[model samples]
Target chain A: MSDPILRLEGVHKSFGPAHIIRGVDLEVRRGERHAVIGPNGAGKSTLFHLCSGEFAPSSGRILLDGQEIGGMKPAEVNCRGLARSFQITNIFPGISVFENLRLAVMRKHGLQFTFWRRVSRLDNVTQEVEGLIERLRLGHRAHTLASQLSYSEQRSLEIGMTLASDPKVILLDEPMAGMSQEETEYTVGLIREIAEDRTLLIVEHDMSVVFSLADRISVLVYGEMIATGTPKEIRENPQVKEAYLGEEVAA
Target chain B: MKLRPFLILLAVMVLLAIPWLVSSSMLNAAIQMLIAALFAMAFSLLCGQAGMLSFGHAAYFGLGAFATVHAMNAFNGEGLLPTPLLPLAGAAVGLVSGVVAGYFSTKRTGVYFAMITLALAELLHALAPHLKGTFGGEAGISSFRMPAWGFGFGTAIEVYYLTLFWVLLAIGLLYLLMLTPLGRLALGLRENQRRLRFLGYNVHALGTLIFAISAMFSGLAGALQSLNIEAANYAELETHVSTVVLLNSFIGGVRVFLGPAIGAALMTFFGHVTSDVTRVWLLYQGIIFVLVMMFLPRGIVGELVERFSGKRPAGEGIRLSEMLPRLAGIAVAALGGVVLIELLQRVMSRDYRALAAGGQWPEITMMGLSWQPGSPLTWLVPLSALALGLALVLGVNRRAAARREATA
Candidate 1:
């Protein structure tokens, strides 16, 4: 690749005794949809956490567009054009869907601590929030409380919140965890629509979804990268079959 | 734009008319209510909205009051920035103190946060008396008049109007704050601090900002109180005062916007009535508190509004037929326990007055019941009554269980 937008070099992390993310090194070019897939407890989520600045690496470095972001706070990382949707739905629950999106827009517009002016009356913010709501097909539910939305609707709102920041890179953690087949298809469409301009790094458990959406796949086992290849190459790898795909297929 | 401002205007007009319709003593009482209302609202911002239960709110109130008093003295009983603007001094001092304390306190959450605030307040209480130069020691500082501001002549009625204006302004501003993004985030922080952190918002900064705003309003109240009463002392900063404000907010329904204001008004009214009618006013307050906690946890205004909004089921008001029996049972149990404990306490003392004062070898006699110090029979009635009360409670529980099972 000409110049990767994100690069992780020998990232390490541990939770007291249990070592997770032993040494994760990966790179993502601009507008590339990279997928990280592994069995449960294989540190796939932990790697995302480290990449997004939710967890500080025990050692090594994380670089965003050639600038090191290792040990930076989540807010600082967010300001640098990297944003992530949580594994669990983590949008503001009490606020209306409109307000939730407005907050993200406000942050992007550098209005986090402006207290004198009323936020609801800001025409620019309201316009942006309304536009995002229309694009996400949440215009009907704009006034509804975020908590009152259906499971799939909330997942879509989560992605919408991440998009509101106008990020260069989007990190999605299992965007279709609890969705029905229809909901999953709808979300995959939304993901594809979003991936047109943004660099995407997703951690997913569903192999079929991974194969369909990912341009490149990195397989992890026991906190280490076991293989990196195209979906067809990964499906055909004998070692990967014995280690992960075999058990998944047998189940 | 239309409804919120109209409501605010209506509230302001009603408050402005209070002094003209009531006696001076009543106006005095109203002023106290306004101050208490402001204090309770500040408490709610931290406790109800932010899920931070502070046991040291009086520290801000007292600090503001003291600062106002000192400012008044410094200005030599003249309005330094007009009497209407005097509250800002208190608010400024409060903001400084709140920020200083909030820096360390926000590092911990939940019970540890409560404990830290409590300890900090207690430390201030201890320091207030020793800082005689500024705090005026146990005597406290007193104010006279502020040279009548732009309204001319310093009268109680004028002071009342000034207080009413400030109260309405402060409450209205707080209401506006609740609709802001920062305010919404504060509520979200209460629900899940970790989620907020992941969303790339500084949870600590949000908390500190809320704390500072709460303190600023509290200080405004304290300043108004000092101007009205013409005195600020150590009593204002005591733990008991903080608890009183907290209780009032909780009793009024912390989550409701106007709940704390109504609660403060009711409490002030209760204080006036009880103080006039009986020496043991605290006992009456305690009894009312227990009753409110057991039956109306949402607070007086909260429950009334909830009912009016049709949130409660139809026909949910207290039914005389259903309530009377429960009331009778509770009355009997409470009386029995009180009598039994009193008897036991007297029996351990020798003097009747001493027992009433707190059992220094006292004796007891009331309504043909008497007990001598060190008598074994003195222990008998208390132990028996306690056992009987436990049995009655258990019997009630069993009855409830049986009813539930039958329905099931």
Candidate 2:
């Protein structure tokens, strides 16, 4: 990769005594669908946090499109064309679904800090939010409060919020967690559609979804990347099978 | 939505017509009510809309009042500025101080935020007497609100109109602020601080901005008070004043924009009436606060809004019918309550002029009618009226619920 969109070099994070991520060195090329799979407590979510600037690596460099974003604020990182969704489906629950999307769109257009003009009168923002709502198939529930939406719908809104920023890189932590099979299938399709022109990095548990979606895969285990290859290469890699995939493959 | 502008117009007309309808003293009371209402609304901007509960809001109001007094004095002494624009000085100081205080206080949220505000307010109150130059000692700063722009504010009524003008402008501007992006984000800040941060917003900056805006408005109210009374005292900065504003906001329903205003008007009038009737006015205020907290947790306007939240307006006149029976029940209950309270107070004090001459049977004047304190009939009438009013209230409530069910 001549210039990877996201690069983690010797990244290490520790909470007091316990080292969450020992040293993670990874590179994700532009427009590639990269998925990181790990068992429980492998610090997959923590790595996402570091990459998204939620937490700085204890000692290493995190580069987003060649700029070192390691000690930067999440907002500054976002402004540099990187967006992420939480594993816990973080969103503004009190506001309407349209308003949630509109805030994100406004933030993208450098309007979050503005107090002079009414947000409701911003024609482009309203149009873009409407377009996003239609694209996400959230039109039926556009006026409903974000909290009132079903769990799957909330996740969809989260992803929609991430997309509203129009980042060059997208980091998703467990996008399909706790979703019904139907919902999972729909989200997979949505993610695939969205990932066409963006660098997609996802941390997921669903093996079948991973096999189908990831253009390349990195297997993280015990705070390190044990393997990184294509689905075919990963499926046959002996180390991956012995370390993390054995139980999943058998089940 | 079309009816909203019409309703606003009607409200403005009524406010304008109040001078013609009421006596000058009543108009003075109305001026006080406007200032108190603005104070409450300013508090609500932070407490209700931004999810920031400030306990020492009187700090801003006091600072504003002091600033206005100084401005007025300057206008009189050196002609530095016009009397009409004195509130702007208050607003400027309030905004500056609010930003300073908010910057530190907003670092910690929830209970800590409330505590920081309380501490800041107490510090100002304690220092006021010592800062005799600015605070004017315990007696506070005094100034003459001179006539400006050919509008002679020599009379109380003229001053009232000026106040009305500023209050209307302040309220209108505050309402417009709610439509802005910053205002929307304030609501967002209240709901989910972490989420806002994740969305790339500086949550601290937003909190501080709202704090400053709220303080500015509060200061504006205080400046209006100085203009009205021609005095700015240390009492304005006391914790008691802060607590009263909090009570007014809560009772008005902090969640509703107009809730605090209604609550302020009610508390101001109630305070006046109770003080006129008895010396234990504070006790009466406490009881009302407790009752409101227990039963009408959302306050006067809040409860009404909650009841009507899900109901679409089928017709305008229909709401009046629904409210009439309830209002009647409330009126009766209030009348009964007031009569019983006054009679009991009179009996307990026993310091009435008629009973001062060692008379066993005290001649009590209840609503201009003579009553013998020793007579059983006197006690029975109030007690029976109380019971009757309470029963009617209960019956009316049940009917209202049944009607709601029918409509649903």
Candidate 3:
């Protein structure tokens, strides 16, 4: 239980002359809600990209369930029990919410090349998609297009897509970036409910939500990890207080 | 849903009765219509469903035609390949060529994908003339349909039935494909390939498969064409064939299942009828295409489907009662435009200019009417009709706008 399900070792990423993520090392333990918090331009999203196979690290190893997945394609990484959600609400916007969820779920049933059987008749995929829709509280909006979803509802849909793969390690980048206080609270509860059986590594800017939801928190500064501990330890640490957490904790 | 089934049944019955009702020459035109319709439907599978607009589909169509002809020559309805089963040769070649071409083309998306397909077809088109044995240069390869399964395979009606059967089978398979899991993924592929990638799907493989399937059916259509005509030529591989299918699919509305077929069939029927009467038929087709694009960008069937199921445009829009007059107004305007164009076409002819070289300005006969070029009423009458139609249509537009504003 204490072993890390996802570990990034000495990961360095550079585009042209500018270095984005510099020698970042982090570990997300199995079944633990871990949050990576940082000020703007702190390489927070870059770290997520590196883990989710969006970009290959210049020099490093990304281990997902004890397998190296640093330079693998996004699909292969997902197949290795790791999944990710984009910060900007990535989903099939033109299709219905049910169709979006089903597209994410049908892969698990080995229906990729399947042409004979009707997708509507797939009871298992339908049931799983329905379960996801209910769990996300989007039952009423199942028939609506994904683009028609409200801001927070789209966020939930993104998270639901991430969960559709039943991944062992889920990387969520700013799942609550743009939301009201009430919506954020609802999402916090929803994340708590879903993250009970899986490991979650979220990149969130909301300090209160981070404090309330994360079992352990890591603060990233200028493409490096400055601190990693519980919320109380992060608040009290002198080094952390002087850096990113000073003004937020005070407020 | 209940109405849809009944409508389909009625359509099928109408298709079945086509052989008995039409003349032999008209039946030949009907055979051409089915081939064009099938080609458009095959195009919809890729362009409409998968969202990959191919500009080189005729390459697959040509490949299928040539392959079928070769199979007929080699086997002659004796052994494994029968006359009825010859289209399988085309399907096999189409699938193989599709896979090869799709592998390279599906690597890119949107404009790049279209360009690659265009280039591939051009390559085949350029090479086809030189490969005499395969594409058969100049005169092209000709063959005869053999008798099999207790049918003589003689007469235009028999050929029409055979073509109709294959086309319907291909279309039915295409329609059923939409309900399948792979078909669902096609919609996903169209929606967002990046999202599908993260969902653990081999996006490239999926794209290639869809492209190949589309090509497979396109090839089947080609086979039907050559079988109907009893010949296959390198001209079938030309870029115009590709563009015609694309134009037909778009004009018919690729978004609907039967829209492209309807458009292709109607266009083909018009082509057969108009080409005999008018020299500027292609120009007329172009004008119609532009008009449809300007006012009805969704294509005819696409517009109809949206009007019925999709959200009403802006306000509730005018009811059918109000719409009838507006449609008549547009039809009147179109008639004026057509008269003006046809008159201008006749006046600009070399023969007309040569005849007027004597300065006689003699009378001309057109559209079953005699008209003197010296008469101003000829021009004024069409212009007035055009004005009246415009005024009527504009009045309806203003009324609809006023209604919407009042409701708001």
Candidate 4:
């Protein structure tokens, strides 16, 4: 199918009196890095939540590989080959970094509800978790509890878990929120490498990372997508310059 | 690591030899301890591993007991459910009830999840008496242990072996289950239920399965109770049954595989020994619970493991010289507190009040000594002990901190 890997058509969400996502529309093609950028309260996170099934859209359709996924349960959305990371670090804090990825990878291996086999003895899963830890540069901290990891390491774990499922589309919600400059740079390179194979939908506040990493950028303003274009096209877009990118990109 | 399995085997052998070493009455108490240990292990699966604090596990345990009793009476313990396999009846009933209750309870999580379990158990307790045929009414159901597999199961020794056999097998299964994928997912459920959803896991379904499995083992424990006593009582469904298992599991350190079992066995043995002498056994149990939560939040076995886990630097280990004084202080404080509680209990008793009507405070004999209740010495002695204990503990803490700083 030639359709975009993830398509959001005229999506709208409202909480009683609050219209958080007001008729937003976007598309993420397969094998490309897509970034969604907007000021605070522009409904960027809400849009991620909508696509991720944290909240059902009040209206409109979300299609993954031309299959309707809007309003589906998170597990159902995930099984359809879409996985996401939270803006706030969401991980199994009580367990080791290796176990967290194993939990993520085990589902793909059809190990859900398996009671007879020991998880430690599942050689493929252990290997996959080890490979993920190495790729995230967290092999040294593999057995440490997720809660004990430094903030940046925890973020890497979150991304590592999201990627473990080998999903067709991956959504990362401001993964670099609390990361240091060096950490962010390392993560930018990491994300770019991972995005080489899978479709990525990321919402990042760091302007330089977004501009440099995204193959296509969607500028959201006031619950609406004002512009969607390549990096060079978005850079020169006058309307985008006025609404969200103001002054920072101009300099 | 190699010593671990050898130790377990040696412990099992010791348990196997208990019938020869202990009196029948002691063996009988050991039977109760085994049953209680099994119950607590079942509970820890849901509470410690899955992180669902169920306030009404007695519902499953009691259901299992009643089911086993009915099975015994129906088959005369000779057919499908022989003396050896009777717990299967309890297991089946427990699993069914667990699935039904877990479906509703797991729909809401945390405090709400706990409330649903409590409500369901309370509902069963309320309705149990009305269901005369099933629950055997107020008097409950009684059954006789029929001979099966050539063992009469007629004496306390026989019953103890029976209970030991089943408890070991059930506990063994539980340990194996913890090593499985489902077992690891239960930890994930406790760690972060929301994250499991995005990881392509049906969190609610997983919770229900775990809850049912826990209830299944609990039912087996109840079955053992019926086999030991040759009866089932509605009294098994009481809230105290639920609370005791919760307390015992927490005390044993639910996170450890055998922690709850050890906690339950230890507490049951203590209860059997002290219930006759002190009416305040439960109060002591409550106090121990509170103290464990405050001072050793990991519970008895949990705290022990943490201390010996070698996670800290070798130099950080408490020296015997430093620990001796602290241990002595704690023992003194405990003895003093027990004496005080016993004295206060006797003083406040209606019998004591009647014995000493109007201005006459009688001397109460305890611990091979007579103490006058109205005397200053009585209050002063225990209070002094408590103060000294507290001071010693605080001093140790301050000293440890200072030593650490000096070393740094």
Candidate 5:
């Protein structure tokens, strides 16, 4: 197989006295939907933070496309084509939905610091943002404030914003944290559609969605990955069953 | 957006015609008003647009004034740079100081950012006089505006026109800036800075740039102030100047594009009126500020814009018929307030005491009437007015609350 799109080599993270990620060696291959599933307090979010450059790993290397990106700032990491969404809805609430997406699209087109031109007159940026709005079904809310959007709609917008950068690797943190069954199914389908030709690293608690979507699953237990395998192999893995999936499978 | 340029043109026309119609004194006041308005707008860009509340904006304003004065003095001797272009010196100095100050200040956010700016301003204010050579001690630097562009700026009217030209151009450029990517990003920075970072924006650097841009305009205002007064003083850098700019911006409505202009004009005119007529002008100014804060928190223009905004959901609006009664009530209340305040001032005044000492009963003159202090009518009339004012204000407020609840 070609080199993995993202590789975490013995990554460890600690906050003062508490060690969160312990020797996390993981590889997310190109064009693969990789899901990290773990119980609460298993440092799943911490691991994502390490990968996304929100916090520097205590020790170890994080390589993105064969480049060391561990200690870089979030903006630098984002500029290198690694985009992420927050577990909490993170968007410019005062700005219109189109503006929120436009900034991202503009950044993708290397217009982050383009101040000479009026943003309203940027036809290409506008066209790209409108396309994104259409794709996310947010055309109706193009001019609405992001704060005024419904929770599910905001989640969808967040996903759309993540894609606006046209990132090589997309990391989604709890894409469906609080959603109805129908909303979840809708988002899962949306995620499937977007993740078609890109590398995806998702951290989700929904077992069914994870099993159905992930080409490979890494089961994290107490800041350590105990098992990583395909859905069938993971289902048959005794350690993952004992550590986490035991109750879900039995149920 | 299409109407914006037309409105700007209209504003320019009105401003240009003012000196022709108004008295020379009023023209002088207008020039100061324009300068203050520009300063306030520069501040609004930081506090209102960028979400950075700076308490020491006068630092840039004062520095600009000094720079302009020095430039005028130095260039006047050389006969190279025109008097009209002296403000560019102020802008340059302002930009340089903004970079120096912003570098240190932008390291922190929120209140810390405010404190750092305040400290920086205070430091300059204290140290400037001691510098002597640069600050000219307490007296400050002074320079004459040289004749330039074949137009001698000898009269107040000419200076007014010069000021009007610079102010309009600055305001126009600033407005255009808001439509630019940098300005839009400043809004985003205010809304969700962390989100911008995730979008690959260096938020702090952008903030510094905004700070510098705001400072440049502020400097221009200061430079104009120096030209108008023919002197730059320590008073320009004082906390009082900062407070004035803050008040003008807030009273006008920081969020609205022209709010600061309206505010600066109102405040400058008010200052002129109070200084001419009343000894207790500051008290009145304080009362006006409090009233504005309590009732018109968004500033005059802000409230008007909100009331008439097309973006407001349909079917909700104020009919003049409904508003006329409120206006009438407010006018009555305002009259009552003025009478009560005037009466109270007369009663407590040192002038009233001097009159009493001279064996004459203290009298108050108001609205074409004079009343002896001992007369029950004097007390009763004002007391009644005060009561009516309170009643009308309460009634209006209750009606407004009811309307809001109904809408909700």
Candidate 6:
């Protein structure tokens, strides 16, 4: 494939004595949906954090669009067209839903430090914020304080905020966690719709969702990826079956 | 659509007319109130808006005061800037002090953060007395109010008007700042610092910027005070002064925009009235504090606004009927126990022979009981009365609670 959009070369990370990620090597092509799945304690979240620059790797490197991005701060990584959504909806609770999207857009438009001018007077910003709110199906709740929103609505708002940066690569950390079945299906559809034009790196635990949505899957066990393949290939692989799906398949 | 600005203008006009109506003493009081309001607003921005409670805000206030005083002294020989520009010097000094303090204090969070600020203020307090030349020892630095730059009036009213003009300008600027992206980010930081960092914002830098702004306003208030009083004393930097500012802000309600201003005004009025009426005003002040903490945790303005607007409470509200009786009873009992212990200790320490020789207390009769102020029995009576009062309250509270439970 034309040069990978993102490449992780033998990335290693550890917290104190616990070696969480042991030499992870992964790659994603442009416009690809790459899902990373693992058993508990497999360091899936740690890998995503490393990719998003929340934490630096112990060793090895990460590259985005053929440029080295390892060891950069989360903000620097974000400014370079890489956006991340938290596993547990990190949003401004007291402000209106529109304001939350506006913040991300303001940041993207390099207006983070524009203190002298009133934010409400930014016409183009307001228009863009309205459009994003409509696209995220949050039009009804536009003026509602974010803390007042339902859980599923918050997830949609989180995705909307992530999209505001117009990122080339989006890192979603368990976007479906605490979401009801209806919410999950809705989010899964939203993910597919957005993934058409941009690269997506998602860490999910639901195997069925992973199998159905991911273009390619990487299974991590004990901080090490034991399998990387299509759904069929992963299901049929003996090592993968023995390590993960063995009990479910047998039952 | 534009009624708010009209109302604000009307309010400003009324405030400007205050010196025309009120006495000079009250005008002086008003000026002090305006300065206190500025200081309280500065404190609230850090404590309320940013969720960074600082105990060393006096550092900036004192720095600003001293800077203005020294500037005034220098102007007597060679004028560096206009008198109106004195506040700017104070602002500059405040910014530097905030940067220095924030660098060390922002390294920690929560209680450690408060402790570090308190320790820094205490250090400054100690240094103020020792730094004889710069701080003017106990007497403090003073300057003559020479007429400069056309707006010269040899009256307290002119100074009050000038202070009112500055207060309005400073508050307006701070209000505008609260509506900015940086302000919103500071609020977000207060809610979730880690999340803000993860979102690619420099949480520390955001905090430092707000700290600097807070210090700038605090310095402005200090500069105004120096102009009003013609001196800057070590008392301005004391921990007690810092605590008073904190208490004023909290009792005023930190969350509301106009809360600090109202709070400063009320505190100034209370201080003036009580000091004039009673020598034991601090005891009354302590009692007011306990009552406020028990009943009106959000302060007068916060509670008033909530009552009128019917808005959801910012904090959990306790039903007074359930809590008040118990609280009052406990307070009375505690006071009684403390008094009883204190009286017993004093009586044990005193020698009867010495008391008689001193002619200290053959002296007083009240309600058919003759006793000296120095008599152990006289002190014991008050302590016993306090104990009786507490016991009665506790008994009533228990009976009430049991009755309510039974009715339920």
Which number leads on TM-score? 4
Please report how far candidate 1 places residue B182 from its true position, in Å.
Answer: 2.8
Scored against the true structure, residue B197 in model 2 reaches a CA lDDT of: 75
Predicted candidate 2 versus true structure: per-residue lDDT over B26-89, tens digit per residue: 8888999999999998888999989999999999999999988888878345334677787898
Candidate 2, residue B19: how far the Cα is off, in Å: 1.6
Per-residue C-alpha lDDT of model 4 across residues A1-251, encoded as one tens digit per residue? 33599999999999999998989888898888999998999999999999988899999999999999899999999998999999999999999998899999999999889998988888989998888899999999988999999989999999999999999899999989999999999999899888888899999998888988898999988899999999899999999998877798889
Ranking 2 against 3 by DockQ, winner: 3
lDDT per residue, candidate 1, B1-408, as tens digits?
467679767877888898788898888888888889988988888888888999999999999998888777775566456666778889999999988888778889999989989999999999988999988887988876566435752677888888887887888888888777777667766766765665667878888888888888888889999989888988999999899998889788887898988788788788987687545567667777787877788887777778767555545555555445555556666666666645544443445555556635545565476665568776666566556655666676576567557766
lDDT of 4 by residue, B1-408 (tens): 888899899999999999999988889899999999999999999999999999999999999999999999985545357788889999999999999999999999999999999999999999999999999898999898888889887988888888898999999999999899999999999999999999999999999999999999999999999888888999999998999999999999999888999999999998998898899998998998899889889889998887888877767886887788878878878877888899999999999998788768879998899998889999899888888887887788788789888997
Tens-digit lDDT track for model 6 on A1-251?
Answer: 54689999999998899899899888887888888887887898888888888899999999998888889988888878788888888888877898788877777666655579887787888899999888788999998989999998998988888888889999988889888998899889989988889999898887778889988888899988898887778888899888988876555
Q: List the DockQ of the predictions in order.
A: 0.45, 0.65, 0.88, 0.88, 0.73, 0.58
Cα lDDT for residue A57, candidate 2: 86
What would you estimate as the lDDT of candidate 5?
A: 0.87
lDDT of 3 by residue, A162-251 (tens): 999898888889999898988888888888987999999999988888999999999898888888999899989888889888877877
Off by over 4 Å in 1: A134-144, A148-150, A247-251, B1-10, B75-79, B150-154, B310-408
True contacts kept of 3: 0.89
Q: Count the backbone clashes (under 3 Å) in each candidate.
A: 7, 0, 0, 0, 0, 1
For candidate 2, what is the DockQ-based docking class? Answer: medium
| Alpha-carbon RMSD, candidate 5 | 2.2
Q: In model 4, where do residues sit more than 4 Å from their true spots?
A: B76-80
Clashing pairs in 1: B349-B361, B349-B362, B350-B361, B350-B362, B350-B363, B351-B362, B351-B363
Alpha-carbon lDDT of model 3 = 0.90
Q: Of 1 and 4, which scores higher on DockQ?
A: 4
- Report the Cα lDDT for residue B208, model 6: 80
Which portions of model 2 miss their true places by more than 4 Å?
Answer: B75-78, B309-340, B343-408
